[model samples]
Target chain A: NAGVTQTPKFRILKIGQSMTLQCAQDMNHNYMYWYRQDPGMGLKLIYYSVGAGITDKGEVPNGYNVSRSTTEDFPLRLELAAPSQTSVYFCASSYLATFTDTQYFGPGTRLTVL
Target chain B: GQQVMQIPQYQHVQEGEDFTTYCNSSTTLSNIQWYKQRPGGHPVFLIQLVKSGEVKKQKRLTFQFGEAKKNSSLHITATQTTDVGTYFCAGPIKGSGNTGKLIFGQGTTLQVKP
Candidate 1:
């Protein structure tokens, strides 16, 4: 089964451009998270959703937005991309809110802003 | 904001050598989780530690949580090429009601040389 799927494995955008990174999970997990990873750095949380229609900002939420319209989908939108936003973005989903179950991650989407 | 710190930003070990990475948090955590990301891959859940002074093993890897619940460690008995990757420790911050949000450490990069 495809646990988590992220579309557009790689993309390049010019400064001030906008794009949405798509993420979907088939496990019907209640918790979903968006994170970015810079070279040689740990993953930084950008946003998270506890369930459908319930979203919250995370540690690094600047220059990004997220929407959880359905339990199977949580997409990240970059309104105006900046050079600093260039990084590998990851989408993860967990079975419950306790985080006791493991988070399954997608392959990742590499975005580069110039 | 709560911070998780990981030591030895990078490590190089020869085959058959032992390796360890330490993670410390500024505040107590309900639970701690470990993940490993291979070169050019997304992070994958490895294990989780819950109880104080708890230790768990997966094959040659051993995971430990401090008695205070503010620190953790991952030790690999013998290094191999398959173990070459970045290891990250993550835990939810005590305050701010970040129930499902995890703060990740800077991560420790392990390079196993044959």
Candidate 2:
């Protein structure tokens, strides 16, 4: 099974450009999350969705937007990208709320905003 | 806002040496989880601790949660090159009213020399 799949492994965007980072999971998990990792900084939550059509803001959601149209897909949109948005973005899904529940992650998308 | 902090931002060790990383949270957590991200890779779940004073082991690695549920530790015995990565600790903030949100530590990067 392809656990989680993310498209456009790498990309470079100029300031004010916009793009979407697509993420999908085949595990049929109900909990999905979007996080960004920067050098010397831990993974910061950008957005999360508990189910289709239900999304919530995370710690650093100012420069991003997310939509959960279906249970299998949670895409992150960068509208008017800024240099601060340059980082590695990861998509994760969990089957349950238990702490022991493992979160399967996608290969991640590396975005560089100049 | 809840904050998770990790100590010793970076460590370099010989292949056979031991290494340890500590994580502290400003507030008590409902559960704590650990993850590892290899070079050029996404964060992968390692293990999780729920109960107070809980300890779990995975081969050469040991994980522990403090009695107060506000701290944790990950120790790797006789580290190898395969252990090179950034280790992160995450937990759900208690009383946040949002059970799905996770606060992550800054992470500790490990470098093992041959």
Candidate 3:
């Protein structure tokens, strides 16, 4: 069912470059999230959207922006790529108000900034 | 912002041995979810524990939620080679309808030696 799908499985960017990471899900979930995982570190929330047109910043939202124009798609934009921003990004989605349904995560995109 | 802490950042267990990981959240959570990520792979939903002192089991994996709703644990009865990976515990942050925002622990990396 392609629970959660992300684009650009891997990417290499130069300093100051900008790119968008695309995430989509077919589960018709109302909650979507963006997270990044670094070497030996736990996943850090970047942003989240409860529903279409509603977005909020999470733990580490700096240097990134997110938009939820449609319930099926939530894209993450990196304004300025830097070495510190190099990490694997993941997208996840879950049903609203259903505490029992666990989140489904995407395959993740590996980004390397030089 | 709430903080989630997981103990024993890294663990190596021989095959057929038992394994356990503990998680604690700074604030009370409505529910706690567990996820597993294999090397070079994405995180997959394992299980969710809700209600004080709740416990759930999936084969040899057992999950527990503390009575205070601020801590949880995952125990594997007998480790196997297939159990090698990083395990993460996540709890939703406090404040109005925070079910969509999750704070993940640092995660415990489990390596099973066969």
Candidate 4:
């Protein structure tokens, strides 16, 4: 399995611009998540989905949104880019709840908001 | 809100030296997991601890879960240049139920000089 994959390895966006970050998993995981990592810092969850059509806000959901239309895809959207949004974004998936499962992460997308 | 904290934000060690990093959660965790990320690379799962006072080892690495399930630690014996990277600990959000949402700790960046 390809596990989880994310598109747009790197991007630079002007203030007020909008964009979508795409992620997909071939593992058929029921849980998918979006997280952002600032330089030299831990990851902060942006959003997550337990399954298709079931999305929820995570610790740092502001300035971002997500949609899980299929078990394999969970995409993140930024309506208006901001400097604070500059970070490396990662997509991950797990077959089940983490309490009893492990997560597989994708190569992150680095975003620069200017 | 649940929070996971890691200590020593950074660690530097000479080859053959022992290295360690600690992780603590604001609330008890049902399970704790560890991941390693190479420079400019995505995180890869290392291991997970489910039972209290659990300990697991892989080659030169050792992982431990606190008896209270509120902390964990990773130790590497005879560190090598290949061990240089960031180590992160993660756990499911305290009240997120089975959504499998995770909160990652501020990672400990390990620098091994060979």
What CA RMSD would you report for each candidate? 1.1, 1.3, 1.3, 0.9
Ten contiguous residues minimizing lDDT sum, candidate 3 chain A: A94-103
> Scoring model 2 with DockQ, what do you get?
0.66
What's the DockQ for every one of the candidates? 0.69, 0.66, 0.70, 0.86
lDDT (10s digit) by residue, model 3, range B37-103: 9999999989888899999999999999999999999999989999999999997767747457777
For candidate 4, the TM-score is 0.98
Among all candidates shown, the one with the greatest lDDT: 4
Question: Candidate 3: interface RMSD in Å?
Answer: 1.5
* Candidate 1 residue runs with Cα over 4 Å from true position: B96-98
Which is superior by TM-score, 1 or 4? 4
TM-score of candidate 3 versus the correct structure, residues matched by position:
0.96
Candidate 2 lDDT over A1-114, as tens digits, reads: 999999989999999999999999999899999999898889888999888999988888998999999999999999999999999999999887555566788999999999
| Candidate 2 lDDT tens digits, B50-88 | 999999999999999999999999999999999999999
The CAPRI-style docking tier of model 1 reads medium
Worst 10 residues of 2 chain B by lDDT: B93-102
| Over 4 Å off, model 2 | B96-99
Tens-digit per-residue lDDT, B4-50, candidate 1: 99998999999999999999999988899999999999899999999
- Record all residue pairs in model 2 with backbone atoms less than 3 Å apart, i.e. clashing: none
- The whole-model lDDT of each prediction reads 0.92, 0.91, 0.92, 0.94
Segments in model 3 whose C-alpha atoms lie over 4 Å from true places: B96-99
Top DockQ prediction, candidate number: 4
Candidate 4 chain B, run of 10 with poorest lDDT: B93-102
- Model 4 residue A96 lDDT? 90
Clash count in backbone of candidate 1:
0
Model 1, position A99: C-alpha lDDT score: 45
A best-first ranking of the candidates according to their lDDT comes to 4, 1, 3, 2
